[model samples]
Target: MPDTAGLAVRTLTPDAPAEAPPVLLVHGFGSDGAGDWIDTGVAAALTAAGRTVIIPDLRGHGASPAPESAAEATAPALAADLLAAADAAGAATFDIAGYSLGARVAWAVAAAAPDRVERSVLGGLSPVEPFTAVDIEALHRAVREGAQCPDPFTAAIAGMVSAHGDRAPGLALCVEGLRDTPFAGGAWDAKVLPVFVVGENDELTRGIDGLAGSLGARLVTVPGAHHEVLGGPHFRDTVLDVLAR
Candidate 1:
């Protein structure tokens, strides 16, 4: 596919006639499109069901170029990149399934371009922005100076970032950008109704019920933790069923 907005997209064509609008699968933080969806068989399942799948490596992740500054990695910016990917894929409107940080970006996209999104499945998401509580200085120190984070949450995030190896700096910038534009589910005014899915054991999504109620949407809880849910068959099946409707 053509490179628009500097995002590297993996487009999968179905074996049979297309059964639905192009499905965009957005991966979570520190994970690329292939790692989150392709390797997990989510994209394959959707494609086998005759849906054109578009997976984009968000800025600062995978093969996509990292953002020069945190400003370039904001939700709106990432949403714009996804839109550009859709345009390149020849999809005027599409269904979206996003996990974790990707879910937040899906929210921004639906809010900004409601007419372009046919439906959305937000997995591993919450009304509360986890980045807001992140200690930015401590995170930066941990990434740059190999210092330990004092805060438990920050330490957790630092560990996730470190797992990405040299991508730690870019991911850290993304964290800062996300913190700057914290998610407020009450403020969401998208016309499209989204199905919210959270892992039953996910403490990070404590306020998901309130967020789903505010949107007049259904919340489906699967058996797993935050990261585990994304790779589970339950989460994949839930997304496929929701988008099929």
Candidate 2:
């Protein structure tokens, strides 16, 4: 559906009334709402079980609009785009699940407007102390050059997950976010949420566990590398587990 970001959102909803509330699946950078995660069967299985699913292409990724100015690519800005989608699509409220960069943006969205989101699952990232100029410059560089990892260590970490097709756009968006956080100006006091999923083998995601725990969120560890879990069979069940409640 059309939204503030002019982004296309993919959805899977049952023809019959759904048993669970809608769940929005946000894929990491370089991937679209569908290719990044929904196509993995996560969204489909949930909808099959009588749940409504919403998947959005964050701005600058996939079919979503890419901002000319750097300011438009931050997580907070992306969150605003989501709100526009919610309004344009007439969504009263819904659960959100974000993976990697999308997960970070989901955090901003739910944190900024807790009531607007029924429940939230941030799949790949943890909250960090406020960003610095170095972070901003790094984001700018990464956004401009899609594959530049700061160090061999980070590069190796990323290379392991690069086999997944959606990583490209994710890298680009990460650059943008690092250069300037969409929610930099806003403060989100991570409210309570039902659950958070982290990849057992992913060090990056493990860091996010600390963030989830601080929010008093439930944690479920899925087996596999970061990208694998996003594309894994159990992902759908883990995602729906939050809504199954």
Number of the predicted model whose TM-score against the real structure is largest? 1
Instruction: Give the Cα error of residue 145 in candidate 2, in Å.
Output: 9.0
* Residue-level lDDT tens digits of model 2 in 1-245: 35545877776668765645577777776567878666687877777778777777877677776665556666677788887776666677777888877777787778667777876766766445223223444443443455576765445434533443454435444454544653222333434464767778876654555555565667888888877878876666777776675
Q: Compared with the true structure, what per-residue lDDT tens digits does model 1 show for residues 57-157?
A: 99999999888888988899889999999999999889999999999999988878888888789999977888999999999899998899999999999
- Which ranges of candidate 2 are over 4 A from the true structure? 127-174, 182-194
Candidate 1's C-alpha lDDT?
Answer: 0.90
TM-score of 1: 0.94
